[model samples]
Target: MKTLKGIKTHPLVQRLQWVFNPVKYMETNVQEDRDIFKTTVTGKGGLIFVNSPEGIQELLTHDTKEFSAPGSVNGILRPLLGDQSVILLDGDRHKRQRKLLMPPFHGERMRNYGELIQKITRSAAAKWKPGQAFIARNTMQEITLAVILQAVFGIYEGSRYDELKQLITSLLAVTDSPVSSSLLFFTALQKDWGAWSPWGRFLRIRQKVDKLLFAEIEERRQNWDENRTDILSLMMAARDEDGQPMTDEELRDELLTLLFAGHETTATAMAWALYWVYREPKVYEKLIQELETLPENADPMTIFRLPYLTAVCNEALRIYPVGMLTFPRVVKEPTEFMGYQLEAGGVLVGCIYLLHHREDLYPEPKQFKPERFLERKFSPYEFCPFGAGVRQCIGMALAQFEMKLALAQILRDYDLTLLEKTPVKPARRGVTLSPVGGIKMMMNGKRTPSKSVAVPATV
Candidate 1:
């Protein structure tokens, strides 16, 4: 097994552009070890995977200034999300766009959603009974969609909420199965025609969502409601540093991105947390004991302070990261990563999946242990499931808070277990990772997060 360190750019490395599904290919036998040192994926083919903590730091923290988002992502997502989307921008433009979008995801701002989180989760959990199987992802998605809708629109029910939910749900239906697709970010595919022709379905769904959003924008504009507390209101009221208001198109793009990014990833994280803790009784017991210490009526701050719960969330993210890769970065100038002399315009990806599972950084990386996060500090590069740098996920804190609270609330009540005894591996679904068949789990009953810690899942 040759390490990528001394290896020259092999012929396979040069042909990486021809590779359509790089992530699925990541595990296949290409890199001699498959643990590290996969081929560089740029036109110049000098990409290197130094899964070391040090390498993670150099690339994500130190070298980030040089790397621009690969043109690949800009090509795919921009069409769906629009050129003004936060995902599409780079450099200063990215910074400004992020700033405008940051308020909704801020810690203080997110704190207000805690009640809604518990309420929504509880509401969804009410319908289930023991012996009846439920898809964990669907439960999480329904709750997440409702919670995000309330937070984004201030309309918890009524025709508006229903209409918006239906439209958004319909749009998401295409990719909601969460199956891994190899074609997520292939830049050249923009020129390639689909064999079956997907544009018609894509356009039809796009029109449905757009019509709903544009209609909402128009309604809000007509009435000009200042009392609305949802994200839409914030966007309506928001003006840039120069006091220039965002256009309706800008509003649609940002709102749509938030709805898409904010909801699904959090739901997936919640589902994985449930699975890992249930599968490992010891871990579940520890989490219960720690959670039990909190007051029955503990506020959002107390839940946020629970160290073990935070660790659990961190570990779940580590084991099966919802997002396997970071926003791509292109080589700005000739550089050497891990002594592989790479030329300018080379492609580099922040291979988050590989880094999280690195044995040196995480001893027994495959094990489900939350204590690793507590024992030592991992460089931002090593532990960045949400990514690092100024371009980090805006909803990182919000997602963590939501996951911790949501899981604590659920675990405190319902006794749940995985429907199967075997483990399910992760694959990229749309832009996030989802379990195959959406994780079948049986809920024993509900327990409020404040009372008994780890209640026994009903036998």
Candidate 2:
């Protein structure tokens, strides 16, 4: 019989706060309505933000039936990912697209990328000399981008690869700040006034990226090879249930989606992991001891499965989840959730940030404690950094794999120091949350393999 509570602030002010300081906005609103609250953050029509584990489970578990995960609700990303991107597709089409794209990111296929990830991480880390300062996020971006380019597209070095990498970095840099990121949130500010304008620069850079993507798709189409195992090749060969291949447009959009989603989120995560590990000497020493247990030239999978290392990565993700909210799930029929009645067509998003910070789920949630993960196992809904359900991140496996392996490679090979004593707060980075100032650090020199005996694995 009760209706969802709505934030009393003006719609425009709420939207601005959501864009400018989303963490503050969510924390402020959650204080009023802990379980579920309605806000005009995405502009009017009442978007519900749910953080309670039971509420989230109810929303995501029944996403396919009781609630609909419509792509139209994700229109905000269309400009960057295109309408054909899987993130912007709903229903049967979305399901089909996911099926086709799922192969390369999971199973034994992921094992193949391990060596490549470590190699890329080492190569990037090699560039940092002792006492050299670098931004953790930028370095991680370089590593992730290279890993994706070669692992997903089979491009390591070439004019096309270089141009594509530079252009994509340039494109992302435009929205690096909240003020610049506003162009994506507010349609009114998305005006293209020329190359001098923010939106205009974004459009021009996007055009270049599209040109490169289309070119790559076209070249691959002309020189089709059945033996190619890269994601692009797999996508080109994949046929839908109707036996029709994806169109050039679809391929281009999906490629951009992978390139953006794959590198951007993973890089932010690795940077945060680096920050947490180095910032806490206890975490850093514990992780190093675990990493030293592996034999020289250890199998990437062995490194991947290290217990304390896994805990560190999990804790990092839990603390400041890269993606704040899951893609919106709309109510398909009248439903009652956590004693509140919701009408058909109600919009809902699982607020991952507040959920992870819940006092009940994670005691002392603000502290960076990797031991918590090792202490207790949480249900998917309770510890979902990668938003659960049908729309859960397709690259979830790869992101974690890359995060663990890359962190292992970096930590095991190099000693680094966190340059900032002050905490770096999470700030809006496009649609995801990233560490402000990107976590500055200085390389201390390469670490030699420890002669100490391997410690017993404890999970």
Candidate 3:
């Protein structure tokens, strides 16, 4: 059997490239080897990066049997999401934690957040004037963070809520650059030089967040509210197979996971969707035509089912996926992948970036084309921005719902424009790729619905 193709560069160099300039690194490597490549940049040991849809499907579909999705492979995230976090657990523990957390993000519980999401968007959008310029990502971050706080802890408009929001935003901003992202990838650089130091600042902010989280957990434990449908309340009330409730640390870890993962990535996505919609005049006009088709009094779910809007969101995700790779899946037994021999513990990651950009899967992959999604359907594996299988993001449904509603609300009610004609480039924002300079834009004015559509009651 032939060995996997890879960059024959030094491991340290590859690691730095992977952490510092991951987009460039991935693009360069993909040009050299189209389908798969063996690399040593992700965490430790050897890792094979799979790009083809068939290969990605093969890996994700049989992940539980021939391969295993272990949380230990996600150690790079441990400093941010603690060991007990669901994202870092494996096997039965992972399954159980997911079950405990699943109820709040799916079904009726998730639907309740729709109105709140639209209200939060409108509330945030109200502050802007016709001439005022704003960073789309930062604004979106505020909306998403507020939405998560309300959905997760059922807290809004309080000192604790305000403080947590400020601290979390500050904490995430600390690692918004490529150089700063290295702090997470290289654990050795995580030093406590002082409170002002990069690592030191992260730790200080984290300590404050932890104190608040622990206090929240303790208070919730002492006074459990069965009536509340927020995620934290649901998690607090859940019992495992042993009929045991989660500990304070477990609750805190999971809360941080939900807070960080839920808001941060979605904010980036919303910003990108807005940027793309405004950037392309044809797209902007088409979206407006579709939005005007719905009555102004339409429910959030009705707005969500819009075809062209869904395609726009999907196209944005396809262009720059939030997560570059699936959580690394390990070989559970000896198996061959595309003629390459595998050991029981070999590591592999489906390169979501490469897969989404493949010309075969998406014609003219570099172009921003929403029509492709509307014209033809793509399989789950072919268009998985949230990953798939056992490791599929539990928040997928909520995130998509929030995106569609928030975008619909903003697009239908507000007129915004990119501040500059230059293109916005995607750069590393912590673990996810975000628009550089937060995709600066100016709010032109509020959009009035067509005369045919009755004005809806304001939330």
Candidate 4:
């Protein structure tokens, strides 16, 4: 067995780069070792970052056997999402939690939220007047946040709902930038000095959010309505093989997990879609042309099925996957990977950002070309924006649904312009990458409904 190679940079410097400028960090390191490399940025023992599709496939496909998706490896997120989140569970426990939570985000149950998604988007758009400048990410966040809240709680309006919305937003904002995101990376920085300190401020807001979550959980427990379809209610009623319900602590953690994962990532993807669409006139015109063919008052599923719209969303997610890295998968036993020997307890992660940008897989990888998707179908291992295998994002179906429907409604009804001439770059936002400056834009005017027409072959 040969020793695995890694970045030559000092551990401290690599860790700093990982926290402060992860894109640069990964790009520079991958240039040194394209397929696989080790780095201590994640922790003391170091983690193996795998960029090859085969390696990622092997790592994810045998996750339950050759590799174990241990919750302890995801300790970096425990502070924000709590310990009991499906994101933080392993083995049978993880499978059971996913079983209970999966229903609300998939199948017909997910489709039920389509009308509500469009309604939220339209309501959000109504607030913007012609010539109004807005941060696309912030605007989209409001829309996605509302949709997730309603789906989770089954209520869109109320004092607790409004307060939870505000508190959760505030809680996440504390880590909106790389500097602030550092608190999550370095345990030493997590000290709560006071309300004025970054970590302190995060703790205070999180406390408030927790109080509200527990209150909602406790209130629902008292009522225990079997008819309620909201995620929280469903979770409360869910019984394990042992016939036990999720505890309040478990409920609180999972709720935070759903909000953070379901809301922020989808909003960033939508914002980027808007950026790419408006930035390229051909793409925008072509998308509108495709959307125009839909009959008046088209249902959400029809809008979702539009090929160009699906490609556009696919390209956006591919260009800058909201989650840069999948949760870490630890080796269950000594195994060979990509020509190198690996030992048990070794940590490995699928570098989603790097994989998506591979020039071999995507020609002119940096260029946003929805046609790539339209021209050919890529294997799941090659084109995964959501991580693959057992730990794949549970909200994958709903996020895609929300993206297509929201983009269709917004583009169909409103004419918006990108404000910046220069291309925007992705920056670290907590654990994920988001558009720098949130992709500023301005509303031009609303477009009148166009009659159904023949679809064009090209833009």
Candidate 5:
């Protein structure tokens, strides 16, 4: 098989580095070939990595025409999201699944989520006390998990919701360590020895989650409420071209997909945003100043449109994209990509990490400067935090809304200070790159009441 500019590292070393220190792996490879290259990182050999905007645009624009974005290429995710999940569907099925899932996260349907997001953020923030240090990521995770559960299941507070939340959190915690994360990569290690084993614990937690999910689904089926706006209710009402409702198994898989994808990635993104905002005093001051211009009780949409807040979120995503690569797009026929020649069956991934760090596109790329977003406008391909085109994140709008509203609420409602001055590096959190230590911080105290912003009545 032909190759792009190849990194010289041994395949075994590359694979281990990719799993253990993915940021280091990508940084080293980009130094060798900034635009495109090949690696054994995907558990498959000869996968091409393309980071340039031109390559990403071509790959995404012509997706399904010149190249096929097959979901089987995303098998790394299938162990978590099942065979029937939208993330694992291909061809017409992928398109149809995306359509069915898109409505709840778009336009007016998304606006309905704003007040709920702020309520969750405020409630979570209320739990923090002055002078007490805590992991910001955990705090953000708590807020995001609640938001997603409400949006996905429409269950605000209940024993089942609490159980589902606890089990999912525990299951995901298994991936916090390199050893446990490797279990997802090595299929043989997935065998269950007992509840004490890593895979065994994962299976057990997953089973409980499954039971809770099925019970919820069955109850909703027996007493379906058409007026409910949650994603689950929306999906329950939707039918495909064949005029068929999703099967219980299909609903379970899709619900799991939305739950996992919706909460985890957004939580990580918000955590990084909080870290950057506090770490850079100027950024923090400017952000608070912008946020304060609005009434303390500003609506979610009002906060979402704040210029500096948007830039802060954009910079955070650019600095360390949660998912480092787009789902692999395969070469449909013999063709040239960017400047390289490729044959049919070749796999391509838009290397989001490298693209964001391109020195030409972002001068002094490592620096967290929100002003870069303000100074210049970038094309969708150029500034894609979420991957572009056919397989772009279905929840892009909701994620952005959550990040902006939650950050705005936290900044206006309470004061926080980073406990560690040293830079926090990104580490592998399952498939996403998250802050290494979850961004530790101390809550100073609640901000004094001021005319700059008014406290929300609901809080």
Candidate 6:
């Protein structure tokens, strides 16, 4: 494992925000160079960096139970989710919540949602016009948002879908800007002039989304729908060992967590994947070729099998993961890592960005190459875009499926090129990390590669 026995800092560095120059100061620095170096965040904020594959493994695995995700990994989300949110819970409560939610995202029931994902992707892809500049991030956001709605509500439509979409758009607009991430480091500043402040204005919008969610929960409760299988319906029907249903408050928190998380971060990742494929045409070509080999209207598992596309998406996430750090876990007993003794409750950031860009494991780490994934597969800790340990993203499978289907659908119909020669790096998108300036690109429509049939975006 790589290590720097000491940490260095300058006075000017202390005043900086982690969100402002995230890749510049942390993940990028670690990516373009060595692993296991102690670095200063703002001059005062110090973290022990583990950029090497092996070091990353130790941080995420091995003694994982010791290093808890602490501080502001979910700071911006706290106001919305409250302390009862699964993201805030640890140990037993976390286990129970995770268990309760797990069933909905699994089994053949989950597979049933793939057709909906494909339909949504097709609808969105059909909107692209040749010669027009399309903002990849925005497009993917719409696609994933629609998919999540259907996945969560078992087919949302009419006033509710439009209302929900509008509310979510408003809520995300505040968080999507680079400013929200900066709030993590400076709570007082945010309370004053920060974009997350009331002046930036997201509360009214969130309440609207929440109102719809709770109202739906209430309606469902008044008329229990046994036919429904989406999370909200399942949660409504769920009873603990005591044969008691979950309260509205518990239901609300879980719904809010899934509703907010379901679409936002996945949208960011899909956007980045599109940008990388366009920015690096060869990678896009490879993805297209691989996607072509899939059977007509392939199943989700088959989508997962498109090795090149899978590698490209995975690597895109590794390079520009939406969430910068993993969920916090605290040490219950004394432990040692990086040759330093750690006490219980000691904080550790999962630092996925730094780990993915490790120079030693990923030579010329910044280059967009998906083959590295095929060349050698790193352990979960080494390239954990969705994080590792038991707390790894519950929606990882869902997110990956969406990316593959969406990308495959888009590439099948249109060919695109970068509108700007120089690319923007990932900056904080609200509570997530995404392309800084929005991935601006122009479309180049191509008919089916194998056959001459026209491909329409809508199902």
What TM-score would every model get versus the actual structure?
A: 0.87, 0.96, 0.95, 0.96, 0.95, 0.87
Q: How many angstroms is residue 263 displaced in model 6 relative to the true structure, after the best TM-score fit?
A: 1.8
Worst 10 residues of 2 by lDDT: 450-459
Q: Which tens-of-lDDT digit does each residue in 295-384 have in candidate 5? A: 757777878888989999999999999988887888999887766778788888999999999999999999999999999998988888
Q: Write the per-residue lDDT of candidate 6 for residues 1-459, one digit (tens) a residue.
A: 333343444634533545566667774455334655545653433455565656566666654355655424455577667566777676667777777777777767667777888888878877888878888888898888887777876547888878888877776665666565454455564453444555345555666777887787788879876988676787777766667676777777776677667688888888888777777756765676677777776787778667888899988887887877766445557777666666555445667777676677689878888898999978887778887777788878788888888888778767667776665777766657778667787776755576332222210
Q: Residue 72: error of model 1 in Å?
A: 5.8
Best by TM-score: 2
Candidate 2 runs further than 4 Å off: 451-459
lDDT of 5 at 49: 85
Give the range where candidate 1 is weakest over 10 consecutive residues by summed lDDT.
Answer: 178-187
lDDT of 1 by residue, 1-459 (tens): 222442344645534422433345554433455334656344335555555566656666654555667334455556467667788776666666777777876757777888888888888888789768998888888888887788876667788678778777766654554321323344444343443435445556677778878888898899987866677787778777888777888788887777778788888988888888887788898899887787777897689879889889899999888876766667688666665665577555677877787777888988999998789877688898898765678878778877888888887767786776567776556766777677888876655555445534422
Q: Each candidate's lDDT (Cα)? A: 0.71, 0.88, 0.85, 0.87, 0.84, 0.70
- Residue range 254-287, candidate 3, lDDT tens digits: 9889877888899999999998888777788788
The TM-score of candidate 3 is 0.95
Clashes of 3: 0
* Model 5 pairs in collision: 296-454
Clashing pairs in 4: none
In candidate 5, how many Å is residue 66 off?
Answer: 2.6
**Residue-wise C-alpha lDDT for candidate 4, range 1-459, written one tens digit per residue:** 688966677889889899888899999889877888899886567889999898899888987678889898888888899989999898888999988877777777876788999999999988888877888999899998998789776656899989988888889886789988888888998898999988888889999999988888778778777887777787787888888888899888988898889899999999999999888778887898898888879989989899999999999999999998887999889888888888888899999999999989999999989999999999878888989888999989989999999999998887677887788999999889999999888887877756542221211
lDDT winner, 3 or 4: 4
